[model samples]
Target: MAIINCPFCNKKASDKSAVCGNCGGKLGEMSVEELDRLQRDKRLALGQSLNNHAMMSLIIFLGSFAWYYYREPETDSLEMYAIHGAMLVGCAWYLVTKVRLVLYKRK
Candidate 1:
């Protein structure tokens, strides 16, 4: 049997086993073709998430601008306040989501 390095722990293992005996890490179980497929999926998911974040920011910016312009001549102080409040909430939500994703991935 050919010896190969484990992808997870970098330990050497025979190609015949499904996992590395040294670290119990799965090795050579996923074919190169499967790894490529998973990588493509990950890239697509990341791209979609990034696009979603950009869209959210754009929406928030446009909403704030519209709120400011619409109430500028009406002498309504609440409009600007509402715009800033909404923007703050949206930013907080985005940050929380980002932090959660990072923490979850660490495990």
Candidate 2:
């Protein structure tokens, strides 16, 4: 088989190989159109995930606050505090992922 450059790692690999030796990335099996379609689908999935995460973050933040104000007891329980903390963490994670996605697009 011919030697081909690995798309993921930029290393030389055999075209016969199913995966890149350097990075273990899938390789050389897909047609050009199939590869393009796969990449398009992957990007679309990522964008959908980002949107879902952002919406979930916003919903959690707003819902937690609304619950705290309207339904929580006069003195907050440990569970309520934990819920808020978890929401904050989730929101932070979503924001960080969003930033990473933006940086990846720039590259």
lDDT of 2 by residue, 26-98 (tens): 8767655664565667667777887777777777777677766777645578868766786687678778767
lDDT of 2: 0.72
Off by more than 4 A, model 2: 1-29, 104-107
**Model 1, global lDDT:** 0.67
Q: Could you tell me which 10 consecutive residues in candidate 1 have the lowest summed lDDT?
A: 71-80
Give candidate 1 misplaced runs (Cα > 4 Å).
1-28, 73-78, 87-107
Question: What is the C-alpha lDDT profile of model 1 across 6-95, one tens digit per residue?
Answer: 655556778678877999976557886664565566656766785677568657766777777776734456766788787777676667
Candidate 2 clashing pairs, residues 3+ apart or interchain: none
CA lDDT of every candidate: 0.67, 0.72
User: Model 1 Cα displacement at 37 (Å)?
Assistant: 1.4
Q: Superposing all C-alpha atoms, what RMSD in Å does each candidate have to the true structure? A: 8.1, 4.6
